[model samples]
Target: MNIHVSYPSRLYSDKLSLDCGSTRICHDISVAIPDRGFTVIIGPNGCGKSTLLRGLSRLVRPSAGKVHLDGKVISDYSTREVAQRLGLLPQSAQAPEGIRVGELVSRGRFPYRRAFSTWSDEDERAVLAALQATSTLELIDREVDTLSGGQRQRVWIALALAQETPVLLLDEPTTFLDIAHQIELLNLLRNLKETGNRTLVAVLHDLNHACRYADHLIAMRDGRILFEGSPAEIITPSNIEALFGLRCVVISDPVSGTPLVVPR
Candidate 1:
């Protein structure tokens, strides 16, 4: 399915609602992910942030309303069609047993290949670039099971990057990473947005990191968005308290000048 991907990819929801089993987590909510920017969703656990991402990426179908991609209904497209336009790095993804890093990463090219097609030069370049982008080129031949926790996370991210989709959704992408690697991954995400103009969305727990790197911030609570705006506009003591029930003082981060939340 050859889908024309326009620049600054458009991905948004309209009156979107979802049900996980019998309970309704996400209500009638409408959110527009910023085109070609780093948008971060911050909330406490079980706040439906992951559900929202799943719905947006079409992993979980919305029980009502719609999720639109490039101005068309997301469900209207085939799975491969959607995979070619959007990619997702889900939380706690497990690689197949004995799968090598290169083999795992190369699987991302499935959306672009024909049935029984041989690997092309384009596939090799994409896999190399993905490994390079995640700084895992040296581990390309290593078995995924042999890698450390952080290394496995990076390899998973490489798999997502190798998909080469215009819009990418990540759920807790910094999990299992050290502070240094977390910062590195965040920087890489921002760089991906700026350099490729890719629309990047991530669900993060660190409010300070979200404020530091996100062009747009969404505060979710009880499966609903309480606030959405630029970090400076949306991240305040009042919003923090409302979102997490934790009273905190907001200060400026000296390094990035973004909002810094300090608990009182």
Candidate 2:
């Protein structure tokens, strides 16, 4: 299979450690996200995958080490500055009561708008483009609380896309979706990579899906990276068994010709 290489992007972590209360999730892990590509993190439950993602997105402060964006420490930038550069669509995001789809998406422009400055045409275009891209334009007038799980996910993605950040991070974006919706979301994510200027990272539980959609696959276990490389190189049966403790056969996907993992 053919794979493309890209430069490292804004997000990177060195010796990163994260804690949940007194328990540490990960320790001394390092990562560099390639610029403008799709990178997926996969691992078993309770393996600190989500915690690692949280650290990268600045939702969880590192107990040790550091996360950097654009070769600078992330903490040096103000919250708004970080927001302008990195966008995160957290798992199971909730919308406010009575908030319309358009209203929820419009919030993405908050970092760009000053307290005294009114919303501009550019903001409107961004929101509209985001809605259209996610196929949520028809739902613009609908209340977010009334949408289905799949529909809500699309809307949330649109909200993130409206942020127009260079790096976007998602945590299990397919968690609650049915098979069709899961495929829909993955295809949408693949299309986002076509721009070749936006970086995408996601934590996924499905090894097959990760192999299919990821340009770079990170297999983590016990808060450490067991393997990191192109899916073609990283999705071996040995890596799959190590990551999930599952004996599996790795084959070429009939559709995409990417690595396909089938558990025995």
lDDT per residue (tens digit) for residues 71-149 in model 2: 7899899999999999998875778999999999999999999989998999999999999989999999999989998
Q: Where does candidate 2 stray beyond 4 Å?
A: 1-8
lDDT of 1 at 235: 82
Clashing pairs in 2: none
All candidates: CA RMSD in angstroms?
4.6, 3.2
At residue 186, candidate 1 shows an lDDT of 89
CA RMSD (A), model 2 = 3.2
lDDT for each residue of candidate 1 in 1-264, tens digit (9 for 90 to 100): 111223333888877888899899887768888888899988999999999999999988898989889879999999999999999999857789999999999998989999989999999999999999889999999999999877888888889989999999999989768998899888888888888768999999898999999998878888888888899998888889899999999999999999999999
Model 2 CA lDDT for position 92: 54
Error of 2 at 1 (Å): 26
Model 2 quality (TM-score): 0.95
